[model samples]
Target: MKRSNAKIISTTFIILLSIFCFFKSTPVKADSLTAKYSMDIELNGAKKTLAGKENVSVHNSSGADLKELVFHLYPDLYNKRETMPFSYTNTKNVPLTEEEKGDISIEKVLINGEDTKFTEDNEILKINLEKNLKKNDNVNVSIQFSLKIPKGTSRLSYFNDVYSLADWYPVLSIYDLKENRWDETKFYPIGESNYSDVSEYDINIKVPKDFVVVSTGKEKEISSTDNKKVINLTAKNARDFIIMISPYFKCISKEIDGIKVNSYYLSTDDKSLVDIAQSVLDASVNAMKFFSQQFGKYPYDEFDIVESYYEGGAMEYPELIQMPKYVTSIEIQTPSTKRYIDAKPSIIQGAIHELCHQWWYVTVGNNEYKEPFLDESFATFFTAYYFEKCEGQYSPNAVLRSLRYSFSKLAEINPKILNLPCAGSSVDKFGNDKTSYVQAIYVRAPLILEDLRKMVGQDSFLKIMQTYFKEYKFKNSSIEGFLNIIEKQAGSKIRDYIGDEIYSGEYKAENLKPTDEEINQIKHETLKEKIKASEQANGSVLGSLLLRVENGEKAIIVKPSSLTKEEEAFVNSKLKSYFGNSYNKLSIQSDNSVTENELKNSNIVLIGNPWNNKIFSLMANNIPLSINKTRVFAQSFSENSDSVSGIFSAKNPKNDQNIMLAIFWTKDVSTDFYFDTYANPESIMIESQFILSIDNKRIETGKF
Candidate 1:
């Protein structure tokens, strides 16, 4: 790997820029809890490593004489072991080579200026005290370590001049008086890997002059020598501190409601992505304000959203969020690749979701290893609310559609997950199955939240969030504690939703009911089907519509176009054979050429994603099924690059008398091969069972 001239120049320019951007530091409040950390680190960019020193002071607030202190060395979980938390994989989805594996060498540890012996087990560092420290006594511990950075998708890794430093430092574990020990939870790669007390931090980082730093706190100072830049940052009452460094980044800053919001991205030689990130930052700012009013006022003075590489789309830190670079790297005008790259929606969703964590997980801290739903559930639901209510941008119909799709996916993957409680399940219960954990914590938990909202009412639900936030801000919250608050707010609560469903792992949606609209839709469809059957029996012409699309775009029929020899044979022979002259006349039309009159009179068929068909794109949510052009996602399955093929039916928007059948396929599928599954009887049977629901409230999806 070689450095470019532009990289060198950018480094120099950033060091110079930091000097002008530094702000004066503010003194810490005297009466606050006295856990504080001061650190200095130098990034070995060329070696993909970090050499650091840390000093942490913690008061023994557990009310018991402390014999030892515990810290979670998260980055060291990358060691080659059977139970290691992470499996380093490359873009090609293969495990990394030995040299790329991450490891941390603890060079020295000192307690009150004396060298101390420490024990390491399963990525945890436990230091013994020579004598028991009395309750309320404070201890200062110092550490020196070298971290070998891995090159892969990681929460803390370096690749291609970009460094994602999350949980890279040794963090003190929370002390649980009830357990009479520190809460030293093992690392679970699927969900949160670290849990710690909210503490103050003063960190000074020295990186190569050009490497721009995006971190968790307010910048206090910046200085530069010839080749290195030193930056000082401070975070007050934050659960964790993170630092992201990249020389390729272009940074933007804005002030929103007294908080400084910063957005950083890798320059793509195009400003479109940067513009998108700016808009996302704005949306996040608005979300933060909405959450503040609805929950509690955010305690932080600054927030940063930085583009980084990770296994997940984005990760939430205290004041810093690592937004997956995939969101900003998308080609705007025309999507370069289909699936997971839809810039606008994904960016907004990620931005709001992560910012919501600033309140739920950061402020109202929770034991993520014990009760992930406390954070993930609220973050997800708030993301929905931001889109549906707070922002007033996404239509209610769209929100419902997306949620219903998620529910269906959960049902498809494992209906048992819907029955299992999300609240009390241990992080280890999810194991390394990221997909199931997400469906349980992110998807199903939100649905449960919505159920509670519907049961209590909107006003009460909003207050519940506010009460919970205010009650537990800057403290550890539990499922039991949250339940007590919401129950008190509701007044007439019996079976606790969180306790019964999430914690006990025995939650079944109770008394599922279909809405009035759903019942009417079913009735309307039944009557329409009777009329169509009667007309067919009386030898009347049965009008039908057939739409053919190519790739995900609408293909026009300006002139007679051709498909492959196999495609022509399937369409003319096999496809016609399956229908067996069911339609009196099949009206064939292109996505670009479909007429309203045809939609009004005939049974219509659409054969592509909404991206290609204007009609489908506009009415997708209005119809029985919804689609995002970038990806076809289901609970059990998701195909990136828009490669999934499915046949679905929904009522034609132009006319109740007409029927529209959509046959969608990915670009890679052969014309003849795409519809092969639709021809299967099992596929049809599964499609027929379209009793859709929202928040476990069943809805009658109209027949196509």
Candidate 2:
């Protein structure tokens, strides 16, 4: 999943952290009892329903007799809002319509071609066998069902003419040998809840000819007619099967190391949108290459990345992933007014993270509801590792710094979080607070892995992971099993070191807390990097005041005392829109009420000319541009025309570490266009100096 929130620590010490090691190998797997599923499903697009019949062949590997077969009816959870795992608040508080409600109806069930007694409740289906089966027995269970596709964004949902079908079928539950029972954990909305054994799938899907189908395995077009089409898909040793259908799907493909990778995106005429899709494609290819070399060879011949509507971050399936459409929809206007070529870093990071699941969750399976950190943490750690080795736009140190910062801030809010066990706790333990859930599983869990790497050295850590992958390929592993692997490779001391941290969740929070000096240094370096990169690439400054404020720096907006209350409210509203949640940290004061301490320590945005704004008057000499009652002075020229306005930033006179951004006009300028243009981080160009006319036309803009 893409991290919705942000993380801590020192620079010189962190740079010494060992880099992850990469390895290459041939494909390998461990033999185990498995299930083979054959399904024929047809989609009724007009009614938003799927009618299907499924036959599952299961081999008993529990070393004991079985009396019944259990399956998870995941789609039934969506039958009503009350049964759904997720909160309606997360869905923008929009109630689901009757047509939007989803449900799965089991019309008939059979065991070995004979009628069987069955019960369905709480999203679980249990079929009682006619007689107790012996050890190592095989059973064929057939189910006929129909499904209603919900209208929304989720793992199994339909929205905007696209259908995302995952866990849309009744899947046989895993039999836990230790407990002598089937794994029947209920679906939890906070984290991944679908848990099943690796199975072989032979699926036949029938859809409208206009609908393009993307699914888990190798797909072959079977037949096509004027209005109907049939496709056959076969997947071997896959943990789960998923399908996506859309008539507006556009595709791009690349082959890496004999593995064909395809990226399916929504059809769009906008060239920029296509470029964003291409970016995701490129990131997926790079991540696959990096993870395959580092952990183990990718066993599959094909991988699919589908861009669709998902409420949260991207989700990982067996051979396919769901990439959020929001990534392609996002556009940032650069100083040159050209759309930024790079998509949001979250999209790139999300692509890499989800692909990592192919190695961890897909091939080497784990019970996600029981131990989500096993896959999520490992995926996140490898994401940082990819940046560290690939040397892309973001570096490992940058990633580490961000993580550390987030941890420290969260720790400040609730010190007890420092003692919470992320590795040992199950997903349900975190409850409904997604923030705390992410903080523990996604944020702190990876830091624990990094700490382990530092303790065992990079080479030993590499050997441990490689051995874990090789041993657990096509098998499910527990926390104990992973610890044994670490102990084998890194010895007892190293195992104990990580074991204590994982079980106790007691981390050295003080060590991770970054010092104020380090924070300031990073702030300055980031500002410099942004300016240098933007200038070198497009000759425009890309840094914005909003960025600084978002970094947790104190900010104050100083307006002229003569300004009307309505004008102040307008400025505040614009700032709120620009800053979003970060706006609450900002303060607004009249020039008469502004204090000297604020000028020295806080980032100041002066909203009036020197003549009317006292704080601007005090700092006029230090700024790059000069603004007075009659004219605005630039570095090379001066404008005396009425309505001439200037916006510039410079070091605060009282404190060089702070910044002072000033927006002043020679006369009464049109506040509508001026504030609407300059106050917005997306519209304003980042330069030390900028001059504009009352009509919102650019007069002069440059950096000092």
What lDDT would each prediction earn against the true structure? 0.64, 0.74
Q: Per-residue lDDT for 439-531 in model 2, tens only? A: 788778777777777777888778889999999998888788889999898888878878777777676545555689767555544544454
Lowest lDDT block of 10, candidate 1? 550-559
Clash count, candidate 2? 8
Among all windows of 10 consecutive residues in model 2, the one with the lowest summed lDDT is 18-27
Give candidate 2 misplaced runs (Cα > 4 Å): 1-31, 85-95, 327-343, 392-399, 413-416, 509-521, 528-704
Tens digit per residue, CA lDDT, model 1, 40-128:
77777766777777777777777799898888888777764333444344333445577567877777777766678998776788998
TM-scores of all predicted structures: 0.68, 0.73
Off by over 4 Å in 1: 1-34, 81-95, 327-341, 390-399, 412-414, 419-421, 492-498, 504-506, 510-704
> Which model scores highest in TM-score?
2
After the best TM-score superposition of candidate 2, give how far the Cα of residue 552 lies from its true spot, in angstroms.
29
Position 5, candidate 1: lDDT: 28
